[model samples]
Target: MRLSPGARERLTIFWMLFPTFLVIVGFYIYPTLYNLELSFTDITLLKLRKGGDWVGLANYWEFLRSSSFFDIALNTVFWLTAVSVTCRMILGLLFALLLNASFLKRMKLSTLARLILLVPWATPPVVAVIAWRWMFDPTHGAINSWLLSTGLISDPIAFVSNLSTVWPAINTIIVWNTTPLVAISLLAALQTVPQELNEAASIDGATKFQEFRFITLPYLIPTLSVLTLMSVIWTFNNFVYVWLATGAGPGTFTNVLATEVYLKAFVDLRIGYSAAIGVTMAVVMALFGALYFRLFGVGDMQEKVG
Candidate 1:
């Protein structure tokens, strides 16, 4: 079959985008291949300055045996599950549902609410992290001062300083910042839902919970699944919160894969080992994303069939 004249014109338009394609290939693909090559070599700051030797998988094997690997892996898992699953997607969906309500729709107040909600998202993550770090400060911090004024506690809590609380504190800021995007995506989906369906259910004496359980939820599931998968990737890659908040300290509690990769490659000057860790993080995120899509697609298929 031959392309139509219209199709040929469209193809010409696409060809005009060749420069952008070349730019992506040059900057992204070329550097990615270079990084992969660098991973297999005994590349270092000193070596780069003086040329280096090939070291096979020695760097990878060393990373595998390193003590911090397991801890960082677990921390990444916690960050992904806690922030992406429980906070970002779940809370975003709830907030979206609330904002999608008919009352809110009529008043146009949802717009104001959404704008306010996006403040964290609009601001730079580094700025947000720094602001949050100060807010969580032990003494003279806003949170501590308020707690003391209200007699909520006798002492200022070491929110970010303590290893145990570090995970939650970092996650809180990430969730606060990222949830708005998720909420906005979900809100758009929710708005496309027909008002008549809910009205019909209500007239049929269906309770609020019943209407939401059957009508609203089924529609949101597909969108929610995609958002959740994306959130997992973003949260797993989150470095700013942990990096700026606790500096991957109280020894190891807050050291996620991204932060650990930076610490290893830049701080420890183990380029090859850090690349191995980077590859591991990429693999884990890819696997999780695949699983998420597969399971959600399966469920969606079953729903459609039934």
Candidate 2:
């Protein structure tokens, strides 16, 4: 039998996408499925050669019953992810706006300014964390040295060792390392906005704030939406800043889910239980992405991008 034109087109598209589909399945879907399977078993490092016993939902139940589960979850969702994402979004937009302004172009300083802005991001995350650790050290750190000099405090304060200041310190490191990407992306988006719109708005006697609110902001909506999703997902899943900076503690006070997963699997040697936490975090992010796209309207975003 001969295929119809529409069927032929559909077949062609499917064949074109087949390689990409295989990659996604191989790298993402398969690993996620394997992790899910591992979550249900009583697997440990000792059971490497032999398959672990199937204990349906036991790991999940154990996670729910864990004493530190809520505290770690709260730290992951709010302190680590929320705080970093919020700060990144705000600072990224500000930097992008400043870089996008005509004053820099007129001053011939755009390239210089961008390169300087990239210094933090271009540095390795581990290096940035270590530098921050030194700065937060109690006795001889830069921050304490400055504060003492300014008479802000009579004594050097231990920023990292103190529970009250640890979260903020970690968040500062994350924001510094990540905000450059956000700013550059937003700057690219800002560049795509037609200058005609701004000029027209100005001719209408609109204030700078009104021009941005009316013309520029609509163009940025799609970019902002994507940045928001990326920020949440990346920050939530990130293990480096939290793990390297604090090692998940001054006695687990600043522990987040990613480090918890590592500590369980590697340190505590509870592979199955750690897989359960990984699976849970994955599910939560999936739901959040779905709800966010639903409320934000993926259709509208595509329309704007197009």
Candidate 3:
């Protein structure tokens, strides 16, 4: 039987997308479903060779009842909020504005300045964390040595070893690594704003702050909204810096949900419990993404990108 033109077009499109659909199902959907099934069981490393009995929701219940769960959840929320708000949004906007300024365009060193700012972002996460760990070392770290030489501190401060300092030290590294990407994205968004809008605001005798508030900021809202959500999701799920830097140690002071999941899965060998944690993380992220779409409207972002 011969198909109509529209049906034939759709058939061709489906064939084109068939490979990609198969890949997504094989890698993503299948793994997710398997993980969910595992989460409902009492599977562990020992039971991997032999199948385990399904004890429905046991892993989830145990995780929820555990004393460390609340603290880990709170730490996760704090980490996500602080990093996304300060580094990705606030400082990012400030740096983007500085780079986009007309005065900076005339400076010979502006390009060099931008490149230097991006160095941290370009560095590998593990490499960056290792370098920062050295810098924060108590005995002979560069930061301590410099501070002592400058008479800033009489003794070395244990930045990563101490409970109070560990989170802040890790956060600093994360911010430095992430800020450049945010700044670059915002800079691109800034370039899309029409020059006429700013000029009109200026001709109306508006102050620099006023011009930005009235013209530049309005244009940036959609981009900022989308970026903010992405930053939050990325920061929340980030495991490298926290794990490599401190390994969620110093008595669980810095253990976020991601690190907790890692520890449970690999260190404790409780695969089922870890899968439950993974599922929880996925659900929270999905809900947040859905709410963001509902409140801000995804079309605005698509239009801005176009």
Candidate 4:
């Protein structure tokens, strides 16, 4: 059957989107495929626009053989699973719940609290790193000063220089820096919850904890899942905070996959091997995404993504 004039007009509207599609295909899709192909070959920083001898899995093998590869991988996984998801979820939920409370309705007070929380978010990554690094300094830092003043410790502690404390320090900066975004998203979800449900729960003699567990928690699960996935990916790929704050110091104890890739590619000039690390990080993120989708159902996650 022949299309009507209105249908053709609608098709013309869709045709207007073709340019965006073309741009995405050319810049995003094509570059991704090129990167994948480059990962398979013995490409180097020197071979920018030329052919490289195919090396199959040699690059990956080389990466696996690196002394610090497993350490970096374990650090990445730990940060992604524990620091990123755990801290963001807990703090986001705490602030979201607090802000949604009826007693915090004074606009000036609310604004001040929100502004303070947003400081870490608004600060540039490099600047934040510098600030955090200074704070963690053993001798002259504010942290040690406060600890000494409060008698929490007898002497200054080298937060970054200590391998055991370095990851926690790095993760503290990351969690503080990124928690505002998650809090805002979760607060929006909280606001959308029906007041009637909460009121009814209260009238039925439900305690605040009970009400949250039965009413609020269920509604927040899907949003929390999406936020958790995002935090996981972002934390796994977190480089600036760890790199600048600690420089992955004490012999690279805090180096995650992203910083490892950077050190390999730029510092060591191992482009292909770094690309393999990049691919590995992507695969881990994809696995997390798959698990999230499976737990929540693909349609639900797609709805959020779309």
**Deviation from native of the Cα of residue 250 in model 2, angstroms:** 0.8
TM-score result, candidate 1: 0.88
Instruction: Show model 2 residue runs off by greater than 4 Å.
Output: 1-18, 304-306
Report model 4's TM-score to 2 decimal places.
0.90
Candidate 1 C-alpha lDDT tens digits along 1-306: 899999999999899999999999999888877777777877775566774578888877887788877877777886635554677788888888877777986997978888887887898889988898889898768988999889999988899887667778888888888888888989987877788999999999999999989998878777777676667777778787788888888777778888888987888887776777777777777787778657768667456334
Q: Candidate 2, TM-score vs. the true structure?
A: 0.93
Instruction: Estimate, for each residue in 39-97, the C-alpha lDDT of model 2 and write its tens digit.
Output: 99888877867878888999999888899989999999999988899999999999999
> What's the lDDT for all of these models?
0.80, 0.92, 0.86, 0.81
lDDT of 1 at 255: 81
> What does candidate 3's lDDT look like per residue over 60-95, in tens digits?
888889999888988888764555456668888999
What lDDT does model 4 reach?
0.81
Quality of model 2 by C-alpha lDDT:
0.92
lDDT, residue 157, model 4: 87
Best by lDDT: 2
Assess every candidate by TM-score: 0.88, 0.93, 0.95, 0.90
- Model 3, global lDDT: 0.86
Among all windows of ten consecutive residues in candidate 3, which has the lowest summed lDDT? Answer: 79-88
lDDT of model 1 at residue 112? 89
